[model samples]
Target: MDTRDTACPPTDSAPVQPKDFIRLIVEEDNRTGRWDGRVHTRFPPEPNGYLHLGHAKSICLNFGLAREYGGKCNLRFDDTNPLKESDEYVQSIQRDVTWMGFNWDGMYYASDYFEQLYQFAEQLILKGKAYVDSQTAEEIRTARGTLTEPGVNSPWRDRSVEENLDLFRRMRAGEFPDGAHVLRAKIDMAHPNIVMRDPTMYRIRHTPHHRTGNAWCIYPLYDYTHCISDSLEGITHSLCTLEFENNRALYDWVLDELDAYHPQQTEFARLNLTYTVLSKRRLIQLVEEGHVDGWDDPRLPTLSGVRRRGVPAAALRSFCEKIGLARCDNMVDIALLDHCIREELNATAPRAMAVLKPLKVTITNYPEEQVEWFDFPWHPEKPEMGTRPLPFSRTLWIEQDDFREDAPRKWFRLAPGKEVRLRYAYYITCTEVVKDDAGNVVELKCTYDPETKGGWSKDGRKVKGTLHWLSAAHAKTAEARLYDRLFLEENPMDKKRHGKEFLECLNPESLHILPSIFIEPALAEAAPGFVCQFERLAYFCVDTRHSAPGAPVFNRTATLKDSWAKTERAGLAGEG
Candidate 1:
């Protein structure tokens, strides 16, 4: 039995709520008895690079649709180009999809159907539908004319079917060197859609495929391979991004001419995120040029990058659902993505205290050997999560930014002679600030109000500022990496219009590593990928790659402030 025959029903038991346009189309298809009320979709990603946030949208749509309609979604790798494709990328893509809480009904690769694809090319030639073109790539491009002008036919277009067949077989049998000849469809050169103007069906590439090895010297192009793969896999709804809208004509033409099982191709706008570059070519450039550490650099929009940056897979799925499907393209605010992460983390993440820039504070009146343990709730509103023991001692570590010698008008944080409530502890009044030879504030001398236990004053006198602190004796030293937008401009590629390279727009302050940050002792044994919120700081996760036993390295996920929420509030206020 086919493994794909075993269908896993949708996890949600609620009645189908067809909200998006894509879902609505599926609904209508089911209503009209299209393909006998069966729905099958596939996420066919080319394994040239790691999957990105943009790919997440397609994955959700395809798998979500399959689940919603009681069908199956196949995970297929469009591994046509061996030059840039690799098994490492294939594994990464699979890991990403699985991490996003999905399992493919069937797994396949375009290379798996190489023999069939070659035979199909011969079938096209026998029907006078395809021919071998000896023209160089540039010659073909020049002949393929502008959008307004019709393309000119290749001089080799009139090759007999026997000659075309022999060349195509030889091309596949490793007889021809790379780029010596290509198989082009014998479609109308004067076609309105430039993509249909005799598109190249196959090309000779001597590079060994990660899966197929050097068994074949020639490979079918994506335009030629994708449609056939879908048909062979019995895909009912072929969903892809709008960039392939032009190519859909060729998709249909090839299958129609060959009398193959043609699936309906639908196009939706691909995700274009603000403060991000999703183009695979640009992403490759970023990786090769060392703009990022690798494909998984937290600054990049790649799925592995975001995953490493501590973004929950659930948050990514929620973002995709919220963005929905649209026919036209638009730039989605990265803040919106951040909003989703913050929302999910705020509710689920355990709270701990971490001081990124530590400033020492000594409680002069407190006994040096005396230690008090206070129970602090993991989440203020979630008592079910219980609490962790927080140690309070004579000395504590506070955020350097929390202290201001020359305070602003509205500054309520620590200042000389000011009283502030330590989170879940007593109120403390700063007596004096100690500085080093360089005159930098090194330590603060403070006296705690013994009566103000549990951050509440018995006399009902309230302190204006509340600050987070860690007991110096019990705190664990850690490395905290803070990440910001990778690109300085909202549209990094837009710099090209202004005669500046996109690299020029790379943000210099994208990553900041503080090696000696202090966190609660409870976080010392935190395993890699463990996510938590640092009180008054940011949501963070143990770095999977760098964090180790006893010493944990944390990556700043997102800030507490929701810029997207603020934007929505401001828009509402403006309307009012």
Candidate 2:
């Protein structure tokens, strides 16, 4: 679902029409006075799962189009399937769209049109265009033969209008068990189009609806409900992904037969990204099986999850805009998505030093109780962002990975007798290595050159490497959650030699929790949802649930270096 090319909002411009084929057609239609110069769009999502990056693209397209044309977009939930839909999902979806910077003209639900749809079904039955079939569910499926064969008509296909009406009313009255009887359109049984072979219009589902709450037992099928709902709303264009292309004929036929206002259905390729799965069912499985924490796990493609992970809506929108709309589906490289966040954060996030896996460094010559302040620029590109004072002391914490006891050739970081610059602080040389009883290098004893204060040498001595450090006394404890790819396989759905489910390929090390991270004390004051770069580590944002006034919890949004760039560079060098 996360793709670089998406229909993101205009990051830097007045509203302009996108150069996609759909827009071009809409433009021509507008020029020719289509819909009387009205441009109304609706983003209809089924209230079953959290909206993912896929929904974000549709949201941008629908809402973005409305914004450009000075029209209004409606937020509609296709909550026809009460078995899966929830009020929680409806509310969450509304919040997510609004958070993405879209204002809905109105709120709507497919259930709102149930009464009108029921009347339409009765009219169809009266006109001999529809019939109530008494065939069992399995019998009906068996009758609806394979693609190469024609389906057999139900034995009760010739039921009179009065009989059909009575049976349908009884079905609605809960007289039938679930799937006992169904209403199907009396369409061509010998039609080449499989959908035209008397598709089901209504099925008996005695379950209580999320909204209606036991108002009726018979539920209208999607094919019967969607087009009628669109017609009721007077949607100018029923824009949807290409997978629904097969249903387009059914959508058209139902409206055409009813002599109702028909909205034009246009299909574009859906968004698919490599190394990620967009299917909500699969996502639900991951969550239910404890493969992921929840829908908003940073590793999830869900909008709330990504937003919680510190990806700006503007960046995601920019990615969607770049991807554009196409007539055919394609798998986008996940690198593009990583690049989008990197592009945005580089310009915006304020940088701060944090030491994960802290290695204690003690300056042997400096006074132990003395603390000096160094002026550190918040951001390099934005000077107006100003500066914050970082406290430098004799005792400091550096990244454990930034030192070596036995230095390799070309190693530029801390080592015995080797000098390195503490970023924005001073030049330091490792004098001794403090090891544990088990011979594990636990800490380093270092001495700083007073002449090289504030990372500049008075004698112009060269230090090849610079390391980010924090004053141990001024450091705050935090929990940092490092996230990696959810699936190890580029395409998880590929069921090859391993006769295992996609869950089997779930990356075991996808999420790593570092419980005792040492960040600057300034970060302790940071509120939930605050975003900042951890100097040399990565972009991180405070977790809203776990972060509070005293305890700060950070989630690694993305790495300092782009992993995709490494792949591309390797590709250029002809490496596997």
Candidate 3:
């Protein structure tokens, strides 16, 4: 996921205790010996789709707080919807959470509490706090009312407690079709908060659950299952996004009516990154409609997508740290995320030469069949990263964009008759340019200065430009994918404000494929998922899903440039 808040090395992130407001709250609670000085949190995600970058915020916050407070955090799958939830989503969620560098203290699913939840529903009916409602889905929505008006009472609102229990039990016994009847809390129909207006606790769905199979014909809704599951597990701080602020009341009402243990429901702003979408239904549509390759497509904001794109777990964590915590919603700049990515890769990724748009360069004065090797360091700043033997030959490849037949003023790259340093090798001056029948420049003929071997002149003649090159004889051709923001607009969702759909705002130039990229021979040893810098270019990772043995594909993780720092940036916010 593209993001601004996150951190590296889970160990580097722990500071005796992280000082966010949430952690401060935990600290204050501990000082008071609340809940006996115990802190328990949970990440309750609906397992219907792959977890996206927005989920990463909650993951880090919950997991990070648990680590700081010496408490435990559970990975709970709120699998309340059978039709949409599945084992595929369940496994993917686990993988994504682990990829983000967190291991849950307890792994569970709401389906595990199905029996207890059903019994609780029955108990509520026995006390007249809840009852079976025979209203159709449409009827219920209409009667639920809007913010300006209060909802009228349901026709069956006054059903006797015994009759409600019998109908609910029969509903669970497979006597009802889907949506024939529902179990709802018997709260006030005219309550100011519509969510607490007799919210449905259970609904009939004969469909088999991913984990429970056909063992259950009725399933509890999220609002009911969430609170009870928290109480049952003894969670002390039930953290949720600010959007769930309204549902907090419903969460408490159920637990209160049952007199069950209550967990404090605290809401924080959800992560919302620019130029990205995190809606599960919309994300699924993008995949199913062939808008993206799959859930792991590098262009997507999915954790798998970012992982495939070569975002390090540490970088994401570092981003979380940069974003910190916010009670109010904000739009975080994608540039800030790019800034973090570039910073992490610059320090860690091994540097290698690559020419995405290869322009052949032949040295006229150099001897044929002659080759020289330079002991090139993997990183210029850190000697500990070590070095590799870089091959140099008479014939070489440079980036086509690096050269200009008609050079611009102050251009520090290659041009005809201009001398420039060929990194790790000699200084070459362009003497000739060759073009195809279409008048497109295809090659350049240059003469290397023998005195400038090892990319330096004994006379100390400084060259402003330094270009990365690969020996034409040894360099391997690999595909390089350059990805950009998925949407041209900063907030794609805002397209609706213009009477248009978000899909129409797709950035057509989001992905560029250079299938004939030439890289340093040493890159042959780089395995899939190994991230490295294409010197003077973007940091790229070996594509894990599309690469084959002896042939690798590179996906651009981030550019070397930091737009956020170099320019005035705005709409800096987190995801929801």
Candidate 4:
């Protein structure tokens, strides 16, 4: 994707509205000079999976606020846990953040703050606010009671601070085996907030860190590391999803006890879309199980995947703006997302003609040896978009569905003895239907109205339907991939309708590939990531994986309408 072309277009230097909660908070904070009027923010992503649309919302919130308030947003990889994290994830995240048009103040990692975090943990232990719990993993789980019940304190809760500090250092030095001993905060076990029930602050993880490598064997847990990292960076507002609302108390308690420079932690509802799975684990399953090509598969919701499928960044930005930030959870219709993309493309994308599943049509009356040229505007509304010369010949290709041997009463497309306007070309009347030996209609023979050039009748005849066609002799052959949702249900994880393993609900028809799509010769040299609207068909992007220099492959980014979703629901109802 072209960053310059896809980013939010330059406005007239007017103040943007506080369209969402994050912006509203920033405005209020600025009015009161909170954090001394500093609006610094950060997009802290766990380097375990590819960034998805949910991450996009966070990116927009962090960077968009910084841009509007003249502050800064840092791109930090919260990579403390090395078990599931990797350098591959780190690279993909950087590429994704850049692709979304966000420039970080600096690239920092949580692992970079490990030594500081460990020292802070020691401070907590010395202050008698933390200890090394010798309980087994299972025993700790048993002691940490249910939500309605208060947890019981461990027998070794009062182990001297000196002893705790020694154990912690030894744990860091690889003296302890995994899960044998963990550094737990000495916060109240009877506290109503379960996270404060002697929560484990550091754990012995033998895995190698992507950045720090094997220099350290111990890692700080997210609950302990996140608040300290935010305080360390002097972040004004630590924003996160509502799932962390329960953990906020632990965040506050850890920073308050340590006397750290704490940032305000705010929770907003995370984004959920119908017919989509947003969980990082499930997304990985799709890739590992060969259910998807990779993180960038068009059917997947990963930012890279969607970009590969040709969704413009502007469209994605518009979507984030439309959804806005809210306090409660809700399922956004994927159709609304599709609508956002279509709305953006309709206003900006140049239209071109391409025929998938083309049916050959030969003008029998016209001389087969002759070919003519017609002018079509690249964009109908924007005459300044100029024109492209399309070749017109006796042999042409039209959409297969555009013709019906037995036409329905309401159908306006071509039929026997029916007349229609060939878009940007001429009026053509169907004269004969050529059949194969099996009595199947293989082709249609038509006659063009020579006087009706550029599809306008000189005598003022009206045609309700205009069909997009390409000359068979002049069309460039290419591959086109049509994409749909990855799941068959509105909420794929609904266990009542779908089993516990909802990955089984994967939509079988997520991708439909047509190898023989014919386009105008202009698209012959289209490079990967190139985007254009395929006239009446859909908006498309050149397939990044397969499309290279001469062999241009386009992926249907989105259709002109949300008919696929409607079709899915209708099919489900029929099944029911």
Q: Score every model by TM-score.
A: 0.95, 0.94, 0.95, 0.93
Report how far residue 403 has shifted in candidate 3, in Å: 0.9
Q: Give me candidate 2's TM-score against the actual structure.
A: 0.94
Instruction: Give the runs in model 3 whose Cα sits over 4 Å from its true position.
Output: 1-18, 568-576
TM-score of 1: 0.95
Question: lDDT of each prediction vs. the true structure?
Answer: 0.91, 0.87, 0.89, 0.87
1-576: candidate 3 lDDT, tens digit per residue: 222232232466556433566777787889998879999999999999998888988999889889978999999999989999889999999999998999999999999999999999988998899989999999999999999899988999999999999999999899989989999899999999999899999999999999999999999999999999999999999999989999999998888889999999988888888888888888999999998999999999999999999999888888888887777888888887888888888889889888898889999999989998899899999999999998888899998889998888999888989999998789999999999999999889999999998999988999999999889999998899999988877788886565558888788899999888888877765789999998888999999998877789999999888887665343333221
Ranking by TM-score, best first?
1, 3, 2, 4
User: Each candidate: how many clashes?
Assistant: 0, 9, 21, 0
lDDT of candidate 2 over 397-447, digit per residue (tens): 999999988879999999999999999788999989989999998889988
Pairs with steric clashes in candidate 2:
5-323, 6-319, 6-320, 6-321, 6-323, 7-320, 7-321, 8-317, 8-321
Q: Residue 536 error for model 3, in Å?
A: 0.8
Count residue pairs with overlapping backbones in model 4. 0
- Which candidate has the top score in lDDT? 1
Considering lDDT, which of the candidate structures 1 and 4 is the better prediction for this target?
1
Over the full model, what C-alpha lDDT does candidate 4 score relative to the true structure? 0.87
Candidate 2 stretches greater than 4 Å from native: 1-18, 497-499, 565-576
